[model samples]
Target: MKYNLFISLFVISICSVLAEVYFEEKFKDDSWEKNWVYSKHPGKEFGKFVRTAGKFFNNEEEDKGIQTSEDARFYAISRKFKPFSNEGKDLVIQFTVKHEQDIDCGGGYVKVFDCSLKEEDLHGETPYLLMFGPDICGPGRKIVHAIINYNGKNNLIKKEIACKDGVYSHAYTFVIKPDNTYEILIDGEKVEGGDIEADWDLLPPKTIKDPDAKKPEDWDDRATIPDPDDKKPEDWDQPEHIPDPEATKPDDWDDEMDGEWEPPQIDNPDYKGEWSPKQIDNPNYKGEWVHPEIPNPEYKADPALYKKPEICAIGFDLWQVKSGTIFDNILITDDLEYAKEQLKNLKDKQEGEKKAKQALDDAAKEKKSDEKDDDSEEDEDAEEDDVKPVEEPEHDEL
Candidate 1:
């Protein structure tokens, strides 16, 4: 047992060492300018990406990230690198997004592209290999998308992953394996996962309901039937409601002034609803008719459906309504442990940032309260000034 454990550990170590990191960007310095490219296409009005401190933890000088500078504008920024494939290896894409402006409707997703991408022409129409991140629009759409491109079409995950809805930093991670399975993680905890073939429509369904098959006319699907011996009671012929015995007409009420007065209605105590026979087991019932299924003719199996042929570049291609979404700590690697380690290091910093943001928010609320009090006081003083103590009219006094 000890020898077998040692062998397994050795194999895992080797796999970890052999894992490749295609590219990574932390946006720590001016290096991001040269490493990244932004869209310059006209008529779209793309927003500028700026490197600055996050909106919440402005005091934390060390924390910096790229944020959109304008609101209600398109954003398309990408970085190019050597093209690599995740055909037989695990592909992990992890990134962080902080919407400090309390975004009402916008996208905070990133896309991985093929080598033929034109950075300047990147827009909504641009094709991509994968897109993963939070996309919120009002209350109806609060989803973290895990979309993958297959054969020229993109398939969205069948399962809905709820996104963290607030002004805090959230880490989104997507992992695709060679076995045609994928997992989605938020803040290093797996949220949703399933087989790629089952969760996405990358290919036609293997089996379909046979269209020609139908239930026979004599098939019985009822679970229960009326008891043949059950009969309505002879005394169950009472009306549902009757006139109240206690209600009386007033003596002063004129017959001509008011229409004929009637006693108020009261529920009949002995009345029961329409009587029916009791139900019993259906004698001839076999089962519910299930439509037969057969192999779909359009289904052509593709073993490489889960494999992303080339993931050469990745960048933010989104729009923001309230602007102030800081994106940072991006890491793309096949090593899941390395991604976890990076996330672990961020926990401490993110906690401190959260506390700092709360403090600022509390201070702003206090200031706003004070301002409201001062305004109320000013309004009282203005009212006093407007009242010239009702000047006594000399003529009226005489």
Candidate 2:
């Protein structure tokens, strides 16, 4: 018994470590250039990716990430790795994206590709297993996409997940389990979660309403009906609009020059239009009819729909109208606790960055105010100089 217990514990420990981490990237230095590959094909123009400190939170030593250097250009960069399968384990992809330029229209997302991808000619049409992150363009479209490629078709999440709108670092996480459940997290907090079968159109439904089923001939779906006993009374037939009984024309009213004056009409209080029988409980009415369900013939069980058999590369293939988006602290793991620990470190760094940014903003505002004051004083001096001094009275030769 003691030996068996020891073996079980050892196996559990190994499993735990296996779930800890599969890949991680902090982009702390230029070492990323050695592992990452960029598009080599010639195009109209492509933005350069550089490793540098964040625009707002500059802790010269620590705050380092990869950012797009140019504006109005396309960016395609990817890193290749050993192929791994997420067959029986949970898949988690977490990364931090910072739009330091307050991006107007851009895509700050990452794509996971299989080994069959051609990294040299990467573009929008390249096949990818998953595309996860924020895509912001104008006011109407600010969404965090959780798209997956299933059976040669791309499926988008049915629900709209809004992305954070600001100039700060935000962590976006996508987690998928073997049970066909998925969750989306922003800054370590879950924002969306549900069954993948319901959220995406990966397959046809298991059961559908029977098209052959029809309503019975005597079926009554109405909830209310007119009362047959109610009838309109003779006095209820009053006119809706009647001539005013007390109104009279003014004495100064003219009939030839000004048009003929007439008494103002008023509404009749007792008038009721077109009376009908009151509605009463519909005793013969039945409840709503629900069509019988039938098994869908087109639906086939795909246990590996959420599996990526050979995920060997990850890339950022996007377009940016205005650039300067920093991406950092990317992690791919199955251990939630490990991901949370990394996120805590990022949160701490962001707090420090926030304080630094606030101080810089305050100083800028003060400088602008001082400049305005100086401009106002200069305008006043100019106005005084423009005024002509009173000319001394000129006498004949005095």
Candidate 3:
């Protein structure tokens, strides 16, 4: 009995680690630094004068350690990461940034890509970046404090943050799924805005600062990501239950933020929700726990798939999954074209209505002028009759 209990506990521990989302580099070296690419686009989709720690990675550094902001251009410090196909369910690029910069945009960010940032990999992959900064999300240039991107449209994950100074190692996390629906978390706070199902365009919505508005001075938000899997686990406890340290945060990094992790009860037996992959039911199960037992709600029920609902097979009304969602149509080949056509039709109809109104106005004006002329002629006739033969009378009087 003791041996069985020990085996069960060991298996459960390994399962928890597999389920969570985090950046893990199993194998890294001097070449990894070269993968961090440098980018400088001021007042653009990301912001003005934005830099990352990943960009400064010089291939010359054989030791590949102790990178600082002054070390390279925009202090771009990042390593190329690629998870095996058989890896866990989802992955996220998590990091902490100290808000240290001359301008308000100084803060850190987390960027995750579907593929590795390799020379052979090139530009085919799309990156989803979560940015956190001091820009307030209101009137002034509509600067977004937090943003996530996919294709062309920038999904403004956070807006309206109090722009302030100091080193705030903010945590920026975004979700990864085949469907592409995602959410943002900052310092454990969840950002609630916009739909991930919406098309990808890192560009801010019109609700942000008007495109024509004067731009603000640019600044970069960056951070140093120490390996969490390092020997001692610097900022975390040895166990997975360990929490992050209380660090300085952006002005709006408050209790009300959407993606922030709620405090967990250290001891609760009744709680059954699993946060890691290890908690999934055994694959050997011949029952409903397997994929076959669960009917594909997306497709028309094939008579062959008829089966009972297992513990995992139960579907929730709130969570509806379509057979297939258009994940990447940012260029808007079909649906966007249809929308534009509808818009043009509406505009043409409006123009036609305006022309009809102008014609009616012109007709009314012409009719009023004609009435005035007739009334004047009638008055002249009356005056002529009233005057009688004034001219002949004058001659007779003379």
Candidate 4:
């Protein structure tokens, strides 16, 4: 048992030594401004961000994060980190988003840019290597976008990944492995994951329909055909509508006064729909004509599709009609374990925040209940005071 424990400790230490954290920001203090750059791109109304714990939180100081402070504006902000290449390692980008404002139409995702990006000029037009996070618009669209840029074209994931909603903070984690696979997590739970190439149109299909090929001239794809021997019934020709048998013409009815004295029309029970010969299986009918596929000469496999050779900056370039999204606990790393640990910490904070919020809600509810009771008592007292003792029946007789 002792030997096994020693071995386990050694392995843990080795794993810790291998993990590398490229960038991490908790927004613990006001000095974040020194590290982050706000875009000054012209003509766009950019919103400012405020650091606060919001209305309720676990801890006032520790929970403070940058929150969007404007409505119907663009938010462009980014920060630089040491350049890193994930050529043979896993890349994980994790962050916490608090939609305390109950955002209606806005983006809460982060974009990853290469070192070539000018932080001050970051905007919607700027290219990015990856974009991953929740985006909500109206009630229909509440999706987590996992977009990848390849060969200068942005390709969105083919699968739909639903995101968390409501006014609580949730952690979003995107993991890209060296094997070209990905996993998207919400609050430390895997929501969607699959091969990168299969989910994105980063490359031409391996096989494509042979444009030069055509169906044989005699090929009959129809599975059924009208039978030549079957004939329509004689009664099948009845009109759809006929004069009602039960409806009689009024005695006062006059053809000269009224345009017509016909009875109301009723559906004919004997009427059959449009007549046609019975259908039978066609003897010569062939199955569906499947287009043969051939190897696409344009397609070239990329083993490094998941690699970002010069990832050094991350940005938030979004348009929010309604703001108040708090972003915090941003972390980019090559270590999966480290990212998982960070997520665990976020989950803890979320639990604490929920307790705090519940307490506040309970207190407010109690106060309102007390106020209502006091009002009722006051109303009862006023009613008693307003009631004058019925004047004793004029007591002159007494």
Candidate 5:
């Protein structure tokens, strides 16, 4: 059942064609860290990308001679971006990566969406489509993601990319044409890229998970919630090797020393959705999720659902031209009064806009009238002069 649901999502996200956030490069360069995060991911040390807030990424790595050897890679996530929902000749989204380590240090890529850099808070809660970045993650252990502020609610649409081979930062970009084609550009070269579109259905967010499974009302973290049914061990903390941070207690606290672990309780009873699978769901447990033909789990899926990527931006829209419709271009009127009211409101709204236009036209007419009045005055004066003709010069020289 679980497997089926997993496949269901994968098929919908992968097989079905939907909307996309097309992108293109604005600048190309080989030296990273100048603009990109050369050593650390955008965090408190690097201030923030969204909201213009947060501490910045760690400067210690660069302050010292510490570079990502292999385990500690860094990224300078973009603070500005244009989603696929904008107008542009073509998205020239470009990025560059450099390797300083003898062993390739993970990977580098851009994430186009809205989300906190925090990774743990992304469980069952409705996120404003925090687009997880698509790099560093490789085959079997990779991430692809997209996000949106759909219906004023944040929706996350993810596609996991498998981990790749030896690590080296490589410049990668995805071009989005106005006609709706996602051409993958690698190192300024056109490589292979596919189409993955989405709207509302394929990413139908699971609203309910564990409704009743909630942090207990009288829950005290220091003391274990007594199990009247006694299905737990008495000395669960006696195990020297446990990750439970709260197990440090007085020796007399659990006099039994029976080495028993208490059964954990659910905080949200309505929660049924996977906290995201420990592994990809395929073979069996079937409801809706499915596997993608080409998975990119950490890819930046959606950013529009966050804040408008930019105001008045005609950047990239959807991959397919059909993805867009003239929402306001054509108006359908049913009720006469209602239609009239709408028209009036539009006119009133346009009233502010038309005022400047009307002023310009009025000024033009005033100038023309002023010219005509001057000509009329000049004509009248000329007529008076003609009536009283001046005497001609006499031939006195003769």
Candidate 6:
């Protein structure tokens, strides 16, 4: 049994290593510009991208990626790969993003477009097969967008997935399976997953309320009703407000000169609110009348909801209020296990960034402390000089 288990583990490892990868971009160097095209579309201020690992990173060269260089501008850049369809396999989109600017309002997402999309023509209006990543605006709108194009319409995922809002690198993974189910991951942890149909309006529901079915005329759906036998108490009714006995009218000159004086009204202590008959278990209550459901005639089963016929291009077509978001390690593949393996180093990247940042912070704090010490010593010397008795002329003292 142990031998069989060992063989099984070996096979799984081999399969994971051999998983297919359709496209990947690490932006290792300036050569990335050769493959990525910038948008030249009219009537917009397009931002440029710089190759950098930013202020902190695990490995300088390995962590380097394309960073947005300008603020309050539109950025549209895309790279085209060999067209491929995820017909009978899982579609995995994984990438790492660092909002080094502590972005206030921006999109750190990538849009996946089909082969028909021109690299130069990519823009906000361009239709895409899938759009997945973090989008944040102010404090309330920090969320990961999982939008899929279905039958010429783009449907957004109804669920809200909170995104990492810090100034460190975070990995976002979206996996769509052939069975019309999906999984969303952040930093190698599963955050959300479910049936695509349930999460998005990709297809009409299989069953719907029957329009022909109607509630009977005598159907009593109320679970509770006022008891006819129980009447309101005689003193249950009371005015909501009453004149304050302690409040006396001001002793003024004459009623003719000024408005008539009256005591101010206050909340009545004896008030019992509005009077109503007590409720009891409803007789002949039928609970809720649920409409019978039938198989929707307009609904059709789509086994290909997961298919994107020709995904060939991936792009960043977004607007940013504050830029300096570095996008790196983008991967589009049909292998879930491979995508998982690729993201295994995400935690290390984040921890490395944290360590680097902490070092910088420590250095700054030490510098401040040293300056304070120097100031204190200088102040003490000045005090000593001030207190030192003036060397009066000895002859004058004599």
Candidate RMSDs in Å, in order, are: 5.0, 4.8, 35.6, 2.9, 33.1, 3.7
**Candidate 3, residue 63: lDDT:** 11
Model 3, position 353: C-alpha lDDT score? 34
Ranking by lDDT: 6, 4, 2, 1, 5, 3
Q: Is candidate 1 or candidate 3 better by TM-score?
A: 1
Q: Candidate 1, overall lDDT?
A: 0.87
Instruction: Provide the clashing-pair count of each candidate structure.
Output: 0, 0, 34, 0, 103, 0
lDDT of 4 at 286: 88
> How much lDDT does each candidate structure score?
0.87, 0.87, 0.33, 0.91, 0.33, 0.91
Q: Model 4 over residues 58-149: C-alpha lDDT tens digits?
A: 77898899999999999999998889899999999999999988899999999999988998888899999999899999999999999999
| TM-score computed on alpha carbons, candidate 5 | 0.28
Question: Ten consecutive residues with minimal summed lDDT in candidate 5?
Answer: 320-329
Q: Give all TM-scores, in the order shown.
A: 0.84, 0.83, 0.30, 0.90, 0.28, 0.86
TM-score of 4: 0.90
Candidate 5 lDDT over 232-262, as tens digits, reads: 3333323323344444555555646645545
Put down candidate 1 lDDT per residue, 173-212, tens digits, no spaces: 9999888888899999999998998899888999999999
Q: What lDDT tens digits, residue by residue, belong to model 6 across residues 1-398? A: 99999998898789877777899999877899999999888888899999999988888889999999998999999999988888888889999999998999999999999888887877889989999999999999999999999989999999999999989999999999999999999987899999998899999989999999999999998889998988888888889899999987677646788768777899999999877788898888998999999999999988888888788899999999998999999998877777777877778888999999889889999999999999999999999988967695657545
**Model 3 regions lying over 4 Å from their true place:** 1-12, 20-22, 25-68, 71-78, 83-89, 100-107, 114-155, 158-165, 176-181, 191-194, 198-398
Candidate 2, 240-279: lDDT as tens digits: 8877989888888889977977777789988988899899
